[model samples]
Target: MVCSEFAGCNEAMQGVIRYNPFSNVGFIEAMDQAMSLTPEDKERRMMLTYEHITKSSMTQWIDGFLTDLKHSFNPGQTSYYLGINFSKKAKHKKVNRLMQVRQGFKKLNIENCSTSLLRSNKCAIIIEIESLPNVKFSRHSVPTADVIETIHGLLIDKRNTIIIVGKQTRETLLNWFGRTHSFNGNELWFAAESGYLYKAGIKENWQKLTELENVSWIPQARKIMEAYVNNIDGAFIEERQSCISFNYKNADQEHGTMFIHDLYNLLDKSLKGTNTEIIYGNGFLEAKASTVRKEKLIELLLSKLTTSSKLDYLFYLGNDSSDEPVYELLKSERAKNMFFESHSNKFICSLEKKPSEADFYLEDVDSVRSILEKFYNNTKKKKKIRSFADLTKITNSIAIESQRLKKGTVNASSIANLNQ
Candidate 1:
């Protein structure tokens, strides 16, 4: 049963194959793979998907969003704020502290220590896909094959590499990479969309969607959105089975706001008492059926991961609000106990000056590449992989370094800001 990309149909049934229509070759390949799966295998996948959808409800999605929204803003201010929430005086204090640390880092002989530190640890890296320089919006509208090859190098390494991204974006990357043909549909595991959907791609399961009754309002909603787009010069409609978006990024703020207000009023009155959800971001207005969230997707991934392997270190890096749920979860005692206690759990930001739950900051995408390259080099040189116990020694040495710096025993070497 090959399923449409979105529609409440994904939520209503279990054990359906999923496909992204944007990639013609990939879509056809997925269909071909589905035909070869055994009936028992299909049943097992279906049961699992059913169990998942039943456990993760629409209400959970709404609650998760509200909770994340609350935590996203600065402590005092209520409106949307993305940068570090420092006051004028606090900013000065922070800058001074950063300067002190920068000096301390420079004084520390880290060049000799870098390889040894990373070589000892078994690392699991959860890097956001869009954070890389090659994938930046301005550089490549879609990821090139070269970018995917770089990512594949990281993935095929000894370390556990997780690329966190939205489902739509992941689909595009997979198409470009020519790796979409998977028998079990476990090719892209860490997407913001439900992992179960990816797993369900083993079989063509569109029949499962047709079994469920259609939402009568979906077509009408599309029509209403099209009408709005037709009237507004810069406003354009993006239609999906699960959502409709009116994008006005090129429009002036005044005109965009007015159109949003008019559309919101119309939708509000027309779709009142229905299950439709309205959400606004940057220069886009969206209405969709609330089914799942990024946090829930990550949570499932974590659970599934435990059955496979144990890691000594975990690093999660992301740049947007969608990444907040996983960040917030890791901040909790439960997630800490489950994943962080025995491991060196570090959350990093790809860029500095961004407000995040990250413990450390990398300057930008270049730093990311540098760090990964360093790690790869270290790993490639090693004759044997180090154990967790051996890894602790490296961490202990870093601790000693910290103490020495605090006691002012180390001389400040020349300040060479290598940024990595």
Candidate 2:
């Protein structure tokens, strides 16, 4: 369960089809069609109605009201595509700018102009005019694949664009590219090369999106684009695994800290602390958590084991400092173990089990739930037990390559060399 869509469902159950956020029609459509049917949908409507007024003369009305709703950053012409997410007060400044934009929209409308609601939030709205326009956007319409191919071809003989993304997505893409590159050795193209011989598709030429998400006509646009570009890889995770995890107590600040903190608490509580732990001290805010006693982490791991028999089928779950010590302990001769980035790619620690399975592996915090779910369904009550081999997509050429696995925890140096 790499995503939340199938969180509570049994492992034997097939995963559900989850909707994409940008399913195309528009956020306005989401407000009107998709969301209206849900309970929370009606709540947003009740709370954000503008002065009991029905919209008509876009500008004379509240053109900017909906557009400026929480609007600090303007991204794609589609206002829905942009705007920083509000998790905590981390975006108070954006909120402030959004209010200012909304006020400006109101003033413009009072002067007798016409516009229509394009997008909206509580603090801001994006208004479009029926007869005039303010912003000029370069227009191109095609499938995402076409754009990827076009750009990949364009950059083929030239330079590669550097992109940044949220850490998870970055890891996911990096893993994919590294694994693929390692197999092919050099010649790789999204359009020219199939993903793999077994199940082939366009190469995920994600490298092309870097420029669009980085270059902007305005400096603020550049900053916003940079933010998205900088965080583009943040969304990747274990695709076929039993868990979803993230640990951001160290890297995020303001709202990001709050966001990770919320997720940590949620995972620890919902999954039950028997298989999980949340690492934070009151000193984190006071900036003293840096000095906390880390020696206790080993004891914490020991406490989780009921038999004290040295973690026979363990999965070391971690993402930050609290995780490092655990990883070290798992790698020691005191235990019998093999590690995996996920459950599939075993970085065979001791050459013990022919790289076919993970006696135990290390996945970042995002994967704990999956590890536990697979563990529970496999060991606790086993009816239809599935081996790790059953989950592989084997290619005739890559089959031998699959048998070869990375040893020990997948570190930055090994990850960097994954494509070789």
Candidate 3:
């Protein structure tokens, strides 16, 4: 790693000789010195260079850079950047102090969900599939292979994993999971179309939870959304089994909002008396049956699980308006009866501080993935002494071996006999 002493070359020149590239004389002298190095010195320099490069890979650098960029958003302010404040009050001083204190404690014990919590408990993890880390909400986008494998591993480890998705159809979900044949029908579950449809496993058929046999308003809503998409340049429509979404992620923000407002009013008025509702968020508007409630799906899931064993922990993650019902349900007093008195529950949103019912927030998709991966890794089973008798026997053998060593009577034959 022969480089000049420049601004960004310091890290690269750490384990090797440096040369002044600007001066011919110095560069030639440095090359000659490098050529005269001993074999041992060359090996030492190679080892150091390898270690440094391995420790500072490009992936790690990019991760650190993105993390720094996210932190620069200024969490204390409601705005994305540091600018003027139109709000009546800024972040409270006491709140900032408490946040700092909490961060310090977090650093001391980074793993909030520990192994003991998972090992001795029956846990349920309900997550909105689109909120997964790095997963785009676009119709063409799908969960990465890594994400699929990680989720499969989590399911195989015996954690009750349930996925809630709004825009994706049952066929899309099946195809996505089909890419990885490792998915088992009994291990994973799906609550598709904002909990209007439920499927217990890959092999099971989707069951409609709502009383309405058919939603006649879907075609009318789709027609209205399609007209809007045709008029808007970058807007599009995604039709699911029980939901229809008007996506404007690629459209002009100001114009998209106006278009969505008009569409929402039209759909709201047209769908009235039909038990249909409309919801709009960041860049999309969706219409679905009002009877399709996530709270009811959760209740059904708990009812089934409680018949076998009480849940000891419940973790729910979401980042959309549709997920608020589940959050509100979990916070209610009636939901507490589904778990033990010492049970733990966490409601997390995959966004920064915002108007959400979630009790905790993660910065972005990457942060969400990192936390789930940690939970998966920590909950793995570990080997331990199964019984007190086995522990006592091992301790007695160690004591006898130490005595033999101290009495100068230890030998290969004695060791073999002890082993026997």
Candidate 4:
């Protein structure tokens, strides 16, 4: 029997066939599945509508035009970029309250709701929260301590650096080191979902947190500080995610795409011996009942964790594929509160939609980039024209195009008009 999720009545998505794969009910179904949103899915249909237009060839041309425009990278403070979707999701007065933490900004790997920004004197770290479940998952087979330490060292060069974790990993971090975490409303609905905030592990009283669900759950600063304490003590606090879920599937016209750059960088580090603490491997089916001994490998990895004195949001992103038995194991362990040996902190972020909770749904990989563009446009700030290099120093097509213009290679169009 076909089951409905969130709000079971999808009249707009009523079964209908079409000729072009993109125009068929299957395509719509795929979009609906991929979004993985909830009863309010219809309210946020624009997420996909906007995506369809963005996936259009014209959108790519625009993206290319902008990207061709240079780049630089300086390790900066981290911030967890999440999404609340719309302004009305919750009452406005609660925005600050919802962003509250029991303690001030500290570390990540120990929170109820993942923090968007964490600050501390020990080291300033940033984190960006993302969720891309479609990509193939692997155990980050390239686990190495020397590499991990070296990367950590580079971030600490300035004392305060940023790190990022996706929803899937957020829950994992919460489990590894008991703590509470959360992001703001706008932060919840960001498109690129790229930002990093350093999070420290810490302990908390779950019973107390539940009581303050409406009031200030905790102050942001205190949360980060608590996170730091947890990082140092290795005693994480516990909490669970709200009830509800969303789901979106891929259509034949398009295959899902994740930030190749993100995965590639991680893989590069692993292969280059820069990040040896993490490892990746063969498919999950390889283990029918037995895949690579995940527990033992994790055991070896956990041993490495002990040597790193302070807590940091060390995260791993995974998706469905035989290569990701570890991802499944992590998911399973999180539910059982068996993240790492001696790990008692427990929390849930609902990386996978449980039903009735997701509000912003989407399909089409282009939609991700597209939705982000709109969000960016909607909140257009009149800051000085930032060079592509200036926009996070990460390579962007817009920056490339801007460079071409600088060298008289392209037409003179305002950066403001790139989206138009």
**Over 4 Å off, model 3:** 1-110, 114-120, 134-138, 178-186, 250-255, 348-350, 381-420
TM-score of 1: 0.49
Candidate 1 lDDT by residue in tens digits, 97-141: 111121111111223333543543445566555555554332222
Candidate 4, residues 1-420, lDDT tens digits: the string is: 122321212212222111212224545676566456564664456454444344446565466435433111212422221222111222321111022112222222322212211221122222112232223322222213332233233332232222333222243443322223322111111101011111222222111111112212213222322322332222222222311001112111121112112222223333342211122111110101111233333333333333444333223322222213433444464523432333222121222221111111233223333332332232222111233324654446568778888898888665446634
- Counted clashes in each candidate structure: 7, 37, 0, 119
lDDT of 3 at 266: 63
Clash pairs detected, candidate 1: 1-204, 1-205, 1-206, 2-204, 2-205, 2-206, 15-46
Residue range 1-420, candidate 3, lDDT tens digits? 566543243334346787544356768988888899999988888897686666666886677556655665444543222222111132221111011111111111225544544554466777777667544544444677777667666665454455545456777777776433433333667776777777766666788887665677889998777767866778888877677888887788887875565577568768888877687554778898777777788788777666777767666776666666776777777877664345454443435445555666666667667766766665544212223545688778867886887798776566565566
CA lDDT scores, all candidates in order: 0.51, 0.25, 0.63, 0.28
TM-scores for all candidates?
0.49, 0.19, 0.60, 0.21
lDDT of 4 at 291: 18
> What value does the lDDT take at residue 232 in candidate 3?
77
Give me the overall lDDT of model 2.
Answer: 0.25
Residue-by-residue lDDT tens digits, candidate 2, 44-147: 54443322233324464364446556464444322122333222233321211222211111111211110111110000000001011112221111113322
Question: Candidate 3 clashing pairs?
Answer: none
> Which candidate leads in lDDT?
3
